[model samples]
Target: MTERAIVAGVPVDTRHWIGGRRVASPGTFTTTSPVTRTALAEMSRGTALEAEAAVAAARAAFPGWAATGRAERARILHAVADGVEQRLEDLAAVETHDNGALLRSHRRGVMPRVAHNFRFFAEWLLTLGRDDFATRGHTNHISWDPAGPCVLITPWNAPLMLASWKIAPALAAGNTVVLKPAEWSPLTASLLADIAAGAGVPPGVLNVVQGYGEDLGRALVSHPGVRRISFTGSVPTARRIAAAAAPNLTPLSLELGGKSPLLVFADADLGLAADLAVEQYDNAGQVCLAATRLLVEESVAGEFTRLFTERAERLRPGDPREPGTDLGPVVDARQLERIDGFVRRALAAGARAVIGGGPGTGDSGTGESGLHYRPTLLTDVAQESEIVQEEVFGPVLTLQTFTTEEEAVGLANGTRFGLAATLVTGDRARAARVAAQLVAGTVWVNCFFVRDLRAPFGGSRDSGTGREGGGWSFDFHCDVKNTVTAPKGWRDHG
Candidate 1:
């Protein structure tokens, strides 16, 4: 299949990619661009029929894919990487149009990471090792066997990149996949299925089904043939998926919601700290790992708040495709309303909006009205308020002050989310101490959102379950088996 150049005006092909072919569905749902508020594509709304077909296809292909040598698998994955590199710009445009993330971000970082996900996992698989030891005159060889079929449900925010995070590792570990992308941003996943096929990934090795989460997602997760599931979304949906997979006892890797905190110490570089704090507004704060809760030392609260609010007010929310756009609209109108509701409630409760407190108009001349929410900063908020505890998942930041290190740690760990946190401090000992006390799975010191990809990445508490990176990814996607054998001398004697 020839790849199409996806742009704002061009219509996209959003069909189900099953068994390396474009499969049609009985109904279709329109996907609108958050930039223009116009229809960009009609996604095939998958049903039980499509779900059953996808699972059956994956089951039939799993044995052959698992039996294939690691070297050959790596080769095909490298080819997939090559395909991604060749179409990076096109993929970036599609994703920007579908999800309202900045096109520059996709081209510069996100798209390259998508290709790297495949290449990195491929190389990691080659150097992967298992346990081999002898005990009590007997030898035990531990091997990793690929789980059968995997169901990957990715979120609309950073759609293709997050999906690749799971798909690359799952495929490298030798599992067949049935990917059900978020209905709002299904175009890039379909494009990826084509890329995989053209790169010689076998039929049914990577299948994509598009539709709503309740119907299509439920069907995929609850399917009897699915052996593993990896989902990136909200906590409530993760719970629902957990309940659905309970019957089959299928293993799940869920990366859910987060109300992560950014701790700024008085001794830290206020300039750099303010820069990092404003970065929470990146992708319009749609990122799950963003440090949305700003906890500042009481002594520096005024200075930090001024710096942060100034930087935030300068952020430009416009058409994602424009090169000058600093931020883009929230995914849709529903998300816009949700973000506004939180800000409105906080204001009614006496929380002060330092800069933005409501929805943004189309005054930027690039995005539609009601879709863009201004980068917001709130101060004088109670520590236990909804704006502080809940995962707003928007360009909204709440500032609070703490007097002591213990109070800072307590406030940072107060939320139910343990996905990630950021600490900005000049003191090495203090940085280490605060980071150790942080309950998050990943903690950033003196920076924000710098990922190694080889370290474990996930959350705790209500944030998520399981981790994925390097060997951790394989651990979730494969079953470790131990085979025991008698010693050579003992076998001879027998």
Candidate 2:
């Protein structure tokens, strides 16, 4: 059964996109808006059968999609980017409504970034050429080919943007995809399916399935037909997917959790460091690469903490639909409760709540719901405390101080995660030196949250297994083969 309804002023089609068509299942689940706690849409609750069907669709379409020439694929991807631009307003609204991201930020940041992901890889692939080398009597040639049908499982935190990160590269590499979007935020993924098909993507080249991870996710990962699986989520879930994919010997790429740290040196710009610290609360601190721990040089710790706490205090949590809202609610009431639990445990273990400490009373004058947490700053938190070491995916930050550069690096790498880090320092040489020692995959000097799609992105240790973005993703989605030949009367070049 299917129903027509308007959610957050946008019309919604409560059906799954499979085989380039709208698929309505007998079973469905209601998706509620995190901002209003109201039903956004009734999405098809996908099952093992649907998962298999979507995979079959991709498998069926793989030969044709993989046979597409590079220029033709680039043209189609560019068209998809243009289509995303046209739907920016509706996409942003749907994302904010379903995922609780601020409307203005979604419009200003997320939408453009999604479009950029498509255009970047689309153009980048054009520059890629096969390798051919000839030396005297010997010749060698190397080529890249698609890795067959792949499954992309994206998290809820930046739904469409993260999906684009995986989807654009896979398609650019000529791999058909079965996208399993988080049930909490499936609206934009569905819309993306429509946009892609309209952009001249062949039927079954892209499909979207919606449901809980246990049912739909397990089915998709373990499906024998899926050649590659790229996922972004928690470590525990990554482990589960890894186990499932193990039986099939499927290639996997995972970008998992992070307890990333931010280091501020004595000679750093304290004002800018403090501003970046406050910006950690952006997206309610639900980002995977969020610098949740602050390691400041002892010499400048006091001033940095004061400025940081002041900025955290000024953050106003409000409805995501409002233009001036600084912080929106966490994804839902469950996340709100989990955030509260982290704060409570931190307080019990001697961490001081220096600013806007506990859960939101929801009585704040901004018409915000109860699912809000005022930006929280924790001081005197133990290095071993759960709140400090674990992934607290909320608007809460923990603070600690280190006296020397060595100690700062040590403290930063103490956690199992090596996803990302930021170092703020005035000296260029010192910045380079410390960044080299830091265990994180991507280190930023004098800045926070700076990203280039052309750069390699992923983590070390438990953070993730492989990298994404730029040529790394291209390499991941495709298989490399080298062919060697020798002239009629040739000897070994070696």
Candidate 3:
């Protein structure tokens, strides 16, 4: 059942993105749905005028929320996980509707992924490691203290899950958050405040502000009270956000774009390689970890191409909620234009369509009902081709063949984006060795885009800074302070 959201009734303000209860000013912004380009709902746009408002709310709540013991904060996150379990259906529907992800994956795949995140962070509280070092019985204990108020700017590709990536751990580590979801997908962010309330989180501890990047984001990033930021999006935007937060010296954890590679060696199971290739683009290749680059061994390139192309073309693109829908629409119109433009330029530069290289549609009328793009594949792309080098964040994938294992690794790491890579090989030793050499934060062998919440996930190089999940995320939200109490006769001066 698709949830027709009553924005006002959701307990969080539809007009405002929840600066906190008994709060929020008169200013607001209207977010339209990509499915219809019609008004979905209106939420607070949060201008710089409200900069004081957001900062005040976060500042007011910061001391109490931060001072609360880690156990209490972890309990709140546990409660959030429980609430997610109870309203999984509602939240899933909201995600599918607002973000246009295939319900099949959003329900079974993404939601479970989110549940795992909350659970993983929640479980970290138990047996939480504290840094204590001993030298000559002069114990030096390191205390983890919250960095105070935080602002999370999440992308539309996986708003709820990514927000959970920021939200769960921040809460677990005793940091209050004010997240601004992509205006293209504000519905779920709107619901987050309600979910937190149900989980017994106090008002102002979690806030959601919706507006365009130029305005609301500027306000949030430049706000004085915010001590840190956790963002997942594009490099350009990350740069801008980083610049804005610079003067304040606010720490940030940024997870920005990728042009990931999927290597299929001659020894890889052809059927499995085909399966991974096809599944890799199912999210309309919106995933930052999407295997948009296919590096195949020349010996088996033909077989891999034949099998993978067949699966890619056969994908039925339609309403994500519809049955048997293998792929759905892109996120919005601008993304559609950008993705298609990249594909066109690639073709003009001599690339050829391998399997699918067309457009897809969405729900009944209005061709632009939802942002939809066809699953496209291109061959004959050069190493320096823009499509190969740039982050073509769509269902468009490029196919290339490499002869040697060294060549495969070389081509895979050639990109400036070092977010993720995939290797499909049956030789366990070679696969392990290649996976090690690949310059990516995460690598999948024989599979792609498999995420475990307990794993330490992050990127290297320009893919942006800091790790999320596991113990690393806890540290991302808190700074360690060493308490050195001198024992008798322990003074170095003596």
Runs of candidate 1 with Cα error greater than 4 angstroms are: 1-11, 364-369, 488-494
Clashing pairs in 1: none
TM-score of 1: 0.97
lDDT tens readout by residue for model 3, 130-194: 76787886779877778888899999989888988888888777777888888878777667677
lDDT of each: 0.90, 0.90, 0.79
Q: Estimate each model's TM-score.
A: 0.97, 0.97, 0.93
Whole-model lDDT for model 1 versus the true structure?
Answer: 0.90
Whichever of 1 and 3 has more TM-score, that candidate is: 1
TM-score of 2: 0.97
- Models, CA RMSD each: 2.2, 2.6, 3.6
Clashing pairs in 3: 29-45, 35-369, 329-372, 330-371
